[model samples]
Target: MASLLPFQDLNCFPNPHTAISNATDPINVGPTPSSRTCFPTLVPKLEPLDDLFEPQEQEQALGNIISTPNPENASANACAGIPQGVPMEDHVYSEFNRISQMFWAAFPDNVQQSGDDNVSNSDSRAIVPVPKENTQVSSVVVATRKRSSQRVKELVRVGDIRIEDERHHRAVVRRTRMVYDSLRILTPMEEKKSSDDSAKRKRPRGDTRAAAMLRYRGMWLNRDKRIVGAIPGIHVGDLFLYRMELLVVGLHCQTQAGIDYLPASMSPNKEPIATSVIVSGGYEDDIDDGDVIIYTGHGGQDAKHSKQVAHQKLEGGNLALERSMQYGVEVRVIRGIKHEGSASSSNKVYVYDGLYRIAACWFELGKSGFGVYKYKLLRIDGQEKLGSAILKHARLLRVDPIFSDSTSCFSLDISLNKENTPVRLFNDIDADDGPLHFEYLTRTSFPHFVFHQSGSATGCECVESCTDGCFCALKNGNEFPYNRNGILLRGKPVVFECGPFCRCPPHCQNRVTQKGMKVRLEVFRSRETATGWGVRSLDVIHAGAFICEYTGVVLTTGQAQILTMNGDSMVYPNRFPDRWAEWGDLSQIYPNYMRPSYPSIPPLDFALDVSTMRNVACYIRRSAAPNVFVQFVLYDHNNLMFPHLMLFAMETIPPLRELSLDYGVADDCTGKLLICN
Candidate 1:
């Protein structure tokens, strides 16, 4: 009988009697080899869910049907009964790719090395292929012994481990593309092998050839020079892509492209003024200010034009007696053309680089004290007026104001134009004491091509001489009172009323024994606008006295080096010039671009309006709302801090102008705000 408790092992003892054995017979070793199997009466099983059962009666006989010695064999048995559609290669590749991904994630930029001989083995490691077809990781690849890319041409198939390569075959793709482009380079017949390729011959030259070869930039240009085709979003290690866009193709004409959409050269992907603005005031908007340049119909009859007009205009036409730089005469394109064996006149220009050229048209000061002058202008190039230039078909117009009041007593620019115009655009602070050599580029004002360079044999007798769109200088010794074009015309930059009357710096010319005098100012600039930031936020300045200065230091190499040297080797006093001291390193370096005030001295703190100062800063002090007026005494014969700053004792007012540093024409002013900020 057994108690109702867990059973114990049965007691089995070795045989009580011991037996001896002779050498002839074998005997069992020290302990008996066969062990005893113990048996005990077991208790009755209970159902696991029974309420009456204790924890010991939990397990029941029907709870298990498991077979021993079968962990993996179960899968084999299961598969034997059912079907698994997954391809063996796909399964292996999937597993390997997952492992590779996890590996890289674990060691992003770190390399693993075992010992002292540490070297990278990542390149040699096999890459597992990623699926290409949308077939749910069932992509099939045929692996041959042929290896010709950045991929391994092998496969491994073990129980659960597998590996393959996934490379795009860039070299092969590039080679095929080169072959296609080469076909286009050959003449029409040279490319013929079979009649199948003949249909492509009718395709336009650069336009159709690109798409067939999968060259996107050229294709985009063919479709339209604006859109770029879709590309992989990642930009890592794409130097070859740049080569394809730039070197292989000659499509740099676009204003902007790539990530930032900046004009290829001039724009560096930053916000800048797009269009210029100009405001000409008249009561009921009737006055045109008689501007030398005006759009076909000005654009800024609204915003930004009113404040400037408010300052200069009153109910009557007369401006304030304290009007700053008002009533000036002309604009000078300093590099005037020399008439071929005739009296000098006729304001004509031509185009080569597609940019029109104008000569030095001077401004007479009439003893108006040099301070500051502001101007409004319109830039227009009409479709009917432009002939064959790139701008011929573009609707181009801009407006802006100009301010030029500098210290140099005078400035002259005579660089010639690509299209033999009378002048290029401008020369700098050098005096216009020397003679100029000018030439003609635009067709004569009349329809005849018997241009000034060759001159018309019939003069005014010619049917269309000086009639269509040009100004005629009496070249080839034609006649007196040379003919001219007017800037007020409906075309691209036409000149008006040019003669010997427009002299610059307006010395004592007020007595006026006037000979064809039309007053204006000539502009030379390296910037589009001299960006200004000061005590006040921007104010709507009337044309009275809006002023600012060039903040660049123009230094020669020697002088720059001296300034840049360590404190131990420096020569000049650290006490900076008043205008530029606060600006510090932001100040312009010399030889960079600005008129006068070079390294022999600090970059002038302020860039005066050329129209007003007319080289007055040679003696004036720097001012935001500057009160005092200055004059140019003379040159620094011995290069030193100017001998004496000459303050002008004058009770006169004059209008003047200056140039901006950007490539914008110096006189466009609508975009020209006095950035009082």
Candidate 2:
């Protein structure tokens, strides 16, 4: 028979088998109980325990065991009346002890219960009633308790069980994972600085004078109407008045002593000692005091000296330099006044030297090895002296207008023949044809040539023969290219015109090219010679007479090379054959411009392409014995950088004679002529 006492009371027995054997002995029944008392007293009160098998259950179960006088005896008496053949509850008691050991091991400290007062120091225990009929049920209960105990041990080992609230524990774990996942490579401070810098750069700055000047720095007069230059109805004096302040605004030229000479005014105490001397050592050999001096806004580089002398280019300040390049454009020259006595009495001021005229201009390398623009200038006589002399000794002569109509294709002030010969276009091609497709560039597109105002020398009011005393005639060595019959000289390379600044009447003899076309011409098909079109004279043209000009887009050498390689047929080489040798060595005395070896391609050379958007000159065909020849002329002398192409009659021609030009033959590296059939 087994004890009917609760499982906790089994702790008092050394062995459940011993107790069962003693209960069967009649001597062990000293305090034998009646049937009702035995059952009720041996069975302890059954109270429901919490889900966790709370410490309170262990305390009450232990109290029942301690209240008994001899727990082992009571257990023996209690089981004395039980049925025989019931296996002793040793396994159940062993399992109960094992579960208790596991619980204590899982929670070595104190177990935390749910609700307000969570902590408890007492050990937890589980109690289950044994069924007298079945040992299998008890074995099942023991297995279930073992599994629950193992689960508790695993929970504690992995640290899933927390002493704090379960919700708070979970929240802390989630926060840790989030922080690890959201980590960034860059620190917070670095990211904020980068964002702030990006925002600052995106903000716009106001329109200021410095900003405006920088904006309009590289634009030309034709592109920007606001620019002051040789524009129609505008004078050179007006530019000086509007832009005098900007002349020295960005001047970078300075002396070795840190003294700048570009300013219109300077402090008397810091006056430069070498005011009259040229900064460049070799400049004095090529230039004289009266020889037009071009003032540069920036200093020139030593490496650029050869290029400047060869090209006759001078670099200077932007506004002043461009304005000074205009034909007959006059600019006042000033020098700092040196004070020998007390500095108080002597004030810094610019002493006006005289006015000078722009003769020629081009781009050249500067001291810093960067590309810079340069200008050539010629001194102009005072207006008062020249103006009075012209009025007294000059005589007005009958002169033809320089242009027939402003709306004509060849827009100039020249007069055309009144023969009424209708001009014709043969094999007419549209501008959008294959390989010739290009945008039409108007006169305004030629910004390098166009000027906002005329700056021609107005002081020269010569009405008749321009004498050597006349500054305008003196500029050309007192020899005009054209005669009274409008016949040009045979060997002239360029022709200068009397600009708007000249005091001479519109009929001045110096203004020949500006007088426009004078012969009747026609464009006709020439399929026989493989030439698309050709031009012929409608009327008889004598030798040395001015013909139409070959006009086209000006392109750099690199651009021209690209066009030629791409099979462009309208490209024409614009080279100065007579000056070619001089170009190789500009300084005859020094010979510094000559390089040790020639480059594969000249970087500064330019060309003209008339394949698309061409003028009537495109009709001219090539021939061995051509009647016309091409000549480079500075028709609009205001822009020295651009040279106009003019056609001259090489020989006398009858009416309807086909006008032709001898396009120079191409030669190979061996100097052998390579004729293209």
Candidate 3:
């Protein structure tokens, strides 16, 4: 019988097999007892992606194995049978899986022994999966299939001229997001330094002022080109949390100035024209009437932005607004309003309200009894609904749920009052036919086999909330993983959140994902093609904001397989694509800079059974270009073997937009049918 015990060397392992050394060559070992062809203890190195290599070069790279002589060996036979045009990584993983299956099949006694142990300990309680020794190797081998099949389709369709404008806009938007993500990291560091010296100055700097100035000095902006109409890649409903973000994306140029304009030397008519303006209700005399905005031009305002300090003049930005109105040029209008959910009163959310034309300009007496330049800006026609208006409406709906059609809602609070915010269930397409009968689950339910031995717990000892240098924060590279605004600073392989063992209160900043449902969400019928039921936020969800956790009954791979064979659908969390690289592409621009780390976890041989009981996340469908992404988080449980599957918004999702995830190939392309793009 083949030995299943651990061994230091491949040769020591009781298996007569050949070891594959590299991608092209296969080393042969003498045949032994069973007909099964066992592989080396170590897995073969994955091949480079074809996109990184030219076609001719890629063919040349694979030529040695395809054209080389094949001898009477299992490895040689497998290498020779590799079909042309197939992805190199796909073949490697396929062979690796075959070897693993054969190896396990050869040891029937060990398999039965492990199966019996799991069966004897099985219970209905939620518990961690048993930690396996070779899980890391299997996880790494499976993790390479990160991009969705839709991404492959997109790559093929990129050359089409019909979508050239769209392609260009997507590239610009991607780069802009990258710049913004990078700035999020840099701004906090700069702010910390500024805060240390804040006492020395009479007027302390705003949140991102110092950082914006530094980025300007470094010229770390998307582009210097200024344009008049709608800026490429920026959508009307796009939201920003900082003024620095607007600067990085080239939507605005000034670090402190509200009005951004092109000088007369750059304008076609040799006259200064306003390009964009921010209306933060800074002037008491300003009126915001949805489509029409009475904007207050820069100057004559005190440092506090409350009242005018001097008489207004028609020059600089004031003159630019007048010229724009006279020349019939459009101006981008952004609205800055206080984030209702933020604890800090200074925190504001900026919304791009689309192109607007200056209709009239005049000097008006402000509320402070002083003259101030005022400009009436009218929103352009045929644009999407205003994002700010949607947010205001959503706020009202939350206060009085009855304001909406109560009959359309199948269930008002699907969480059964478990979550702090109520999750509504609505079905307008059909006659209030709610989802099939399923018990509501707020958290993951693990099997009873998870070993729970009493051990000394390790955690932070913060009195109120965790701070930098705490145990939990230290585990995350000695820095708080979340910003003061509760946004994740950067995506990592794994996020360590404060658990019950920690002395900090439940509201600790370190426990971000643990806080259930920060945004109001609802289950709605999707009108989009091929989409059935979908989840959407009732309020604006910022990028990196924790939406909800994938909660359901967790089962071992063995249990899941039996259930699958018995016609039960299962969700393999490990098989979800790793698209965290989309968060930022700074490495493409700066060679030394590293891309945002994708959440990497070991291949968890477990599946979530959501048929009987599941959360709202189950309703979220899959998409190639998804607005949400799965993140591996550990907080309530101590098992690295099984982390909670948490979903976070990959980008700013406008209210009522369907939430989708990039569900890469199910089983990581291990010959299983593709579940989603």
Candidate 4:
């Protein structure tokens, strides 16, 4: 499980499951002055009792620092110092109540009521004071609540996983994306802050990524159990931006080790077996040819000096591969490739290439002239197209769409010359026409709408472009919404962009979202029937790259509600998920950092009627974890109530990957398009 806790040694907590043995002795209750045989004390410390509390309740309950009686006096009754009239259970309960009161009083404003109703009602009850004789007794309860709370959350999150959901693929994929999105948002801010603080020592690169993974490690899926076959909900061609992401998804349980295996103790035959392997060109002797890989065994390298020092032995992963071959077991194969356009610190992207089996195994000398073990892994047949192959085809498509071999595109440009880059329409799934006929609209259609809030009429005076001190930049907390590379620095409640009335040029840096679509996208029928028609990019869309604006005819909430009652799809601005909040959350890294909050905008009563006149965003699918997010921008118009809904990439999206959004609606909630207020 070393992969499960990737940052354990790098300032993160120890192994997540390692119990804190320094905890004080448990409360031993002597038989209640009636029985001859003393009842064995069932201590909470010895049992896995943290799972007894609800996820939310554990956070509020575990925050309180409570002390327990010393282990030396464990043989005596807990109520030995209490008055004779009080029962043992009542006396112990009263003592806890008194301590809790003291804890809450220490930080009165920080108190959060427990989720359990019975626990919350105790605040109204009278608290019995500690006896004068017991005052000298030291508090012995250890600060193990942090570890318990983490375990509690892990169980709670795993319990929520549905094995039978049709959207299982989307569910797991989204969870991975959400965690990375938060990481992406924090890293840039951390780097910028470090650069400005010359007096402070600079943090090593990629520390934020490690910190984020550790902070939310409990919420990771597929870690509770290891499956030998294909991981349910994880599909071939799914791309991960980092190696840890593979751990998060349980694709490969090793953080750095190329091979992950089930130990002899875990295997049914009592023989270690290999489960998965990552081919990243780490060893020069290893060979990879599309469907087949000549994998290298781990060990024999001196990591401290970064070279081979000893000959390899068949004891660990090397032996496991031999056993897997004898058992005819399938192993998951993932290919890691260099990401030339990576925006994040990690320069490599990992692709899940489905399952493989060990065809043969032997020992050999390596390129470094040291003896090593080698295994031949041949890809199993009848799986989806290899992810690496799809990437190569995508590169060719971007270069010349017409020359690509596979027959899918029926129409070259669905926008009909509206957008700068043509949005291709493909339908190899079945004989279905494009989405219901709709007028091709590039901008939001507002009929004589005028809204003038405070500071809405003002415009920046930058002649060529806007920078740090420009009015537009100052409105965004003295930082431009995007960097010189046009990447978003952070998510804000509302981003002010250079408007038409501004003196800046049309191509100003501040007008990123205002520009028409740049990358090529396609509206195609998804192979997964549940998702229906979805949008996928034909080009690599980097993190924070402008995708498209949610454009259509605008309508009042009342009008939209009436139409919705008549069975019409209406996009509500408030219904869009507050995904940006997590994207900008700094509490994980800086507990005291009060994240910048912009002045609240007036209530948005407008809704876009994309049922008719619409853009490519109308086809994007809704997911709990979405790779694209809507950013509210005010540029085309002065109306604060009707801000343009611009969509941007939440991460570096690979080609042919379906784009999704967290449509901030409950699972039971019915149909509605995205909205962000």
Best by TM-score: 3
Candidate that scores best on lDDT: 4
- lDDT winner between 2 and 4, please give it: 4
State the local distance difference test value for candidate 1. 0.20
Give the lowest summed-lDDT range of ten residues in model 1: 486-495
Candidate 1 residue-wise lDDT at 537:
8
Q: On lDDT, who's better, 2 or 3? A: 3
TM-score-superior candidate, 1 or 3: 3
Tens digit per residue, CA lDDT, model 3, 107-187? 112223454242112111111121223221111100001122111100000111235454455555654464555455445
Clashes of each: 85, 25, 2, 2
Listed in order, each prediction's TM-score against the native is: 0.14, 0.31, 0.66, 0.63
In terms of lDDT, model 2 sits at 0.33
Cα RMSD (angstroms) for every candidate in the order listed: 38.3, 48.7, 28.9, 18.6
Over the stretch 410-473, how does candidate 2's per-residue lDDT look in tens digits?
A: 2111112222333433333422222123333222124343444324534466766454457665
Residue 527, model 3: lDDT of 70
Between candidates 1 and 4, the lDDT winner: 4
Model 1 TM-score is 0.14
Q: Residue by residue across 1-677, what tens digits does model 1's lDDT show?
A: 11112112112211212111111121111113243332222121111111112222111210111111122233322211111453434321122333332121112122345464223243222112221122111121111121222222122111122222212222222222333232233212222423384475333332123222332112111111111111111011111111122212212211111111112111111111011111112112222222122111111111322211111111010111101001111111001111111111222111111111111111111111211111222112221221112112111100111122333312222223321211212324444422122221111111122122222222222232333222222321121111121111010111122122222222221111112112222233222223221111011111111122121223334654554443211111221223221111111111252322322332322221221112211112223223222221111121122211222111111122121111111234312322211
User: Which pairs clash in the backbone of model 3?
Assistant: 126-446, 127-446
